[model samples]
Target chain A: MTSATRRHVLQYGLAGCLMGLGSKSLGATTSSGVTDSEIVLGMSAAFSGPSRGLGIELYRGASAYFEHVNRQGGIAGRKVVLKTYDDGYQPDPAVKNTLTLMLEDEVFALFGYVGTPTVTRVLPMLKKFQERQIYLFFPFTGAQPQREPPYGPFAFNLRASYRQETAGLVQNFVNIGRRRIAVFYQADAYGRSGWAGVRQALKQYGEQIVGEATYRRGSKFTGVMRDQVEILKASRPDAVICIGAYAACAAFLRDAVDLGLQVPIANVSFVGSENLLNLITQGRDDGERYTALLVNSQVVPSYHDTSIPAVKQYQELMALYAPSAPQELLTESYTPFSHSFVSLEGFLDAKMMVEILGRLGETPERGALEDAVFSITEYDLGIGEAVSFGPERRQGLQKVYYTVVDEGRFVPLHNWQTRFA
Target chain B: MSMPKLFSMPRLFRKTLFGVFFLFGVIGVSTSLLSIYAVDTHLSKEYEANSKGIAKTIADASVNILLNSNLTALQSLIDQFIEIQGVSYIYITSETGEILAHTFVPGIPEEIKAGDVNSTTTVERSLPGMGDFIEVGSPILAGVAGTVRIGMDTGLIALKIQRAIGQQIYLICIIFVVGVFAAIWFVNYAAKPVDGLLNFAVGLAREQSSDGAKSQELLARNDEAGDLARLFLHFSRPTDGHGKGPQSGPDRSKE
Candidate 1:
């Protein structure tokens, strides 16, 4: 080869090597690491795990909102960066990933990290960080600990809690004069938390759980659920409450119908994934036979209808940034209720982060962000609800929008004037 | 007396052409695939989000209608929902399984009929909040009460995604066709230098017996061809007759 050619080859090889090394170093640095022009928020979600759909939905919702904010010159001229990591709904990796974001990457906050077990494991670490005063807003879990005092000061809950949701579910049955109620709950913290709420709500009616059934998560409870359905039927309870995920809830409904036990089947919000509706109607000869399906609910403003200002804004942003997406796909059916929940919450969180950043006055320290969240009172998101936080109450949403499943979709029943249950 | 066709082209020129073509082919194909994947992922996520957003909008509008005491308003709301870009139907009911309003085909069942609502029949499917209906519920006013359910036809979204995927695949196919043609051109160009070298060796062999005395003169030309001529002379020495001798043959063998 010519001398010049040999030198050229050597230079190209060195350039390739240098590029590879640079990428490796960049990859090694966690995404949460913020710079002067941008602040990164970290999220670990069940992107590929059992609850992967929920995680993916949450990510989509959060990303849509963030993309919109960033387009509008971002929050106070500092671009918001959401660095999402998928933990596959597992707790160990979630804790590890969260710690890496907090310690190594130094993210300004942790936003919308999903899953109950996953968030539960990281609670202690989050508490430590909170002691140092870091903001963790709108974590996906509605577990009581994350919302109760001590840890509640650090965390901001976006969804109506299982307690609040269950109270709403039971209150619906109570409104219908269904005095004898039974709860079929998953045997976990989520189910227990909801069941506790149901029990507490029923106490006001001078009654208790007339019939209760529990099943493990991810287990096929068809036969067990059938037995529970039969037992619940025997008790002749006016309504059946389901405090579980979509799979369990769908299976219970399918099996209950098979057993010919017909009653109002109430469910928690977690069971509200749109896939469940398809599962329920998949092969049924009478698609409308499952018309009595009811999903107890909480949701933000709908993004499908252009009638609402907030929903219209959400659609406009989604179109601008995500134009390739089908216009119809922007509807609420596919995402279940998560799009409304996360988008509204994510926007509020973005606003709150901006407010906190403003409180710090130009250059923000982590301490100022924490104080800002704690100091928030009646921060409204234009959805007719004001988010308030105090020393005692960390959960911002006091109102729950109770919705029901009518004809294979969730329609709002009404906003409860008083907190149900 | 005719020079070989392959040896007519200079080896360096042929090799340079080959290197350029090969580099372009590799870079082009890799870039196309990477771009397609990135675009596809971005679009799929966008599609999913849009579907969810549409569903939420219908639910919200329905909820507002239910909150108002006007059943006529609720019916108008359902009609508006059906008029929405992607909505298929909107149904409203009470927690007691009473079908308050519906936007469906004719022949509504007695159980789901508007006036003949089934108060005895409760919603039995396992959904989130318990009620007789599917989607959102009208807040219980002093007298107003019911559930507002909105159903969206997702086929439009699916069709949109399919079109996007089809467009991507078409682009990918175009790129692949271009890639194949480029690869063929590259492989041919890359092999050209080797062809030239073979012809040069044949030319040297043909002239070998004719001008032993003039060989040194031929090798003195200060070009790539002359360099090869000199190397050939050094290799064809009597001691390297077997073409595997220790001294000069090893260097040629290394080449």
Candidate 2:
């Protein structure tokens, strides 16, 4: 052949490769956050702040599940990648980080967002970009906004509402004949949400709160705990339900015990059970009497409860993924896995997300994912109960389990009936 | 032998009388309607403000007591709210819609079901036995706890409106009655010159001198009635000041 004919053949081959690359880019751009070999998700949580345990551990648990799936040849042969930004649990930064995730990173959906304050700020941005159809799945709050109308359409919750948690606590207490109740809450949306739940639950038993006190939203529990303890002590309540974070709750409990007030203090799961226990038992006695009296409502079952299929799976997954947990997490009190309620909740949320995504077939679009979540009805999540959703029901978990700190570890309180009887 | 003009009235007097009555009627009706509208609007706003205020206070006190299982305190709180002037019923409800303490018999209204306490909502409803009342739902601690509902009787608002309307009606009636009397007096005073002119014309037609003095007095005045009287006096006598009267003239007046 002539030299001119060989050159013409090489040019034609180069143009063909260019057309193929262009087509791939067009296909990748058509889907919001899906590519030929990847599905990218975005999250904004407090990865580096005072609340890092919740945000970082929740991310860790979720990433562990995602990594496990990726290693098993990925979901539908496409790797799940989560890009998270540290909002520091503040609303302003949360808004900026969420917008960056939506606009710059161009992620498909928002997953495992933490805090009611942060989520509240993120919602308006979602509303502004509603046509984008960014599904906020399993936010770490039972605040009413995520469960009610307007915002409900955009949010898919995995845990029980604060109302349910407080209701369970109130019901159990009332069953035990503890009629005189008081509330200690942080003065914010999260605290108020749990506070509301306690009220709702008590109302069912034809009872009302005897006293209520509040600490500042982001207080470090130094000076405010005294006032809260004093206020609750004055009420002489049979039990005090605390709607606050681990530090504040731990401080309040410590002060209450120090003041010789021996009433039972209850906390909802949002108190971060492991963190709260760590705070309570950090420098305190190993078998403090207050430790046994402090009860907490857990949205997820006990980390050591291998009887439940989910707990077993969670432990196995944690062992496989998080091989080097912090030293403090391995203390004699609670050693069944890293053992953080927030982490377990995050794992469950990711597990459910994978379940829903797996059900949506190979190529799930944005709207299809949302519709699939709503269509989930009576679907068992292997935690001794089934999660269901409909047009009206957005919350997946309705049952709340109670646990008390004993010997510096959380133990399931399954005998409220016999004890009360 | 000319018959007196049947029911003769001065044209000016008739127009003035009709105009006065029509103007008074428009003013009376407009004033009455405006009074009713103003009274109703003010009363409605006042009742709504009062009802919402009571509902908010009850909600603030309710959540703590509800959670603490203080049924007695909750009951006492509701009782105290019930004593507020227009409050017909007050109730505390769980987030699940259970009523803890309620002054009403049937408990929480169906319109205000559970999960209906997300925000501050108010509705004017008429209960079967409670009569018409404005129902307000305020969430305890921004709806984190539960809801407090207060039903303020529309009876007081209605009564206020009714009393205001009655007073307005009475005032309007007084205005109308006074307006009628004033209009009559004004019309009579305004028509006196016309009456004089009419008598002058009648005397000219009958060739009489009794009404001449009155016509002279009317012509002395400076008004439309005076001008009319002057014209009547001028035509009744003659073009000249001392021309022949109707008795000696060609007697066009008799014809």
Candidate 3:
């Protein structure tokens, strides 16, 4: 018999077994408990933790996009139901919540799950459900682990990863003839990943990390920052790479200034939180003694650029969907990096999914969906880049634009495409 | 030789072993495919970016040379374009199809004559700096109106891609081997309980008789399976035990 026929027979047999076992009751349902018309998507994010700023910003962005979609009559005529759970930047609860979403809530797919550890825990579970054809997109982590296939086919990345962004940042630094770099990281996966990139980039120049320091999450680091300042003072490096959140980065900068370590402090894109510059400026105890030391790289374009087509579209969407949010929040600095492009990314991926669905012509099986994603080529997202997928490569956008904090604003450095170390 | 049975197969343990092996096999194939995809994507992107960079660099260098030089010197320097590693040919022309300078390969059409400075040629080919080979007449520079054409062999880019793919395949193989072992260990861990239950069931099925001594012996065996057996025995004999016997055994089993 043909492979198709054999597959049909096996499917029939599996269906018979499932029916006999009565495992249909194991499926998760919604609040109204509807399974067919409503498509539920689960997202676990750092909604109320130290990283809540990013979490809240991303939520607002994704919500705005979904609201716009729903208002426009939804995807393929079916409305998307986003069920968000707060993971509080912790992994244990994140795993529990994810299990609830998958096993109890039975979401159609997992969209916008945030954090590396949280997503890492769910990888095996996601692999198990690969046969069900669950699509995971814009997982907040830029860890290469998520983008590696068989996981990559199901998981799509929206933001450029820390590795890609850091490479751009370091290359720009190198272009400007700055070596003798110091690194201040969060002592976490996110921090270390960017650190790895920085180290790799600096390797080309025959330079090593001259000075290093780290901060534990949620700990007050005034004294620790003082110590780090002393270390950086001793090392006297040309640039200090900060790979922590806004608060930690702010503390380090303030302390570094007090210690007379007047080196330029550059940071990864994660430090692009709202009012980060305000915090740095606030830490400037004297009025005229403003240290010319603050610099942070931005992965996305400044939302303030009203001239950009993508930004214009985002503004329109925000006005229509999330009118309650302040106009300033939608400004260039305050807007989430992903906010500028998440909807567009979603639309592009959704478009691809629809094409695959059309190819399947009504009920596309899981294998067909996999094939469609794998077989993609010249798939233009209409944002900035075109996406192509083949038997071996799966990442969508590999380019990152570096911007430094200039006069309390992010100034564009030259754009650099990502490369593997 | 002795005649073999039509459907001879291995024992239950061996079957389970084969199942585990098959599971790993699926994971390996899928992982291989994934790694290939990841590496190919990474390299192709690198190649495309590199090509674009090379093109831009060549274009920039040509513009710089033209901008720094006057018309006579530019005409003399145009001949030096071939000396650049990736530049194939350089053509300098006016808005009117005048052959200001020409670096030609042996026997192409003489579209432009030396004194024919006022005739126009249509743009035919979509070459980088100028247009196609046949109709290469349009003016690139507006006021000065000169064109510089450079051709690069994409062989280096291809070689880079190939090298990247090879490296990636090796990395993927390493990851695959490690992942397979991890998957096997994990599957075995998850299936341990089921394996224990199956063993217990087989043992029960092979039991010679369901006598009092066997029942006492089963009760003495106080693990989870023994508790299940005791409960089963008590349920089968409705009135054999003292004061709610089935209830006690079931309550204990439930706990």
TM-score of each: 0.53, 0.58, 0.51
lDDT of 1 by residue, A169-240 (tens): 777778767778887876544555566678878988888877766665554323346655765676677778
lDDT of 2 by residue, B29-111 (tens): 88778877888888888888878888888887777667765443465456556767888887677776655555543123445
Q: Per-residue lDDT of B1-255 in model 1, one digit per residue for the tens?
A: 123533454565456645766776677678667766766677545544543455445445555445532333344345445556655545666556554455543212333343323221223222222123222223323124544444334455555657766776677678767765565466556555445445556666665552544454544445554566656655555565675643652123322
Candidate 3 runs further than 4 Å off = A1-36, A128-130, A149-154, A220-224, A282-291, A323-368, A414-421, B1-255
Per-residue lDDT of candidate 3, residues A1-421 (tens digit): 2343245336534543453344236443222212323445677766554565555565666666567666776555545556666666666667776776666655556777766646655665677876666667667666655666435556766567777766766666666666778878665445555666677678877877776666655433333477666766667787788777766777787778777776667776666434355566754546123235555665455565656665566666766766222222122223343333323333333444334433432333334555666666776544556666555665556666555444555555433222101
Q: How far does residue A150 in candidate 2 sit from its true spot (Å)?
A: 1.7
Model 2 per-residue lDDT tens digits across residues A305-394? 899898888888888878332222221222323757788888899888888877666776787887788778888888987998877888
- The parts of candidate 2 lying over 4 Å away from their true place are A1-30, A221-224, A323-337, A417-421, B1-255
The RMSD of every model to the true structure, in order and in angstroms, is: 25.0, 16.9, 29.8
Candidate 3 CAPRI category: incorrect
Q: Which model scores highest in lDDT?
A: 2
Which stretches in model 1 have alpha-carbon errors above 4 Å?
A1-33, A129-131, A219-228, A282-285, A301-306, A323-359, A414-421, B1-255
Docking class of 1: incorrect
Per-model TM-score (chain A alone): 0.80, 0.88, 0.77
TM-score value, chain A, candidate 1: 0.80
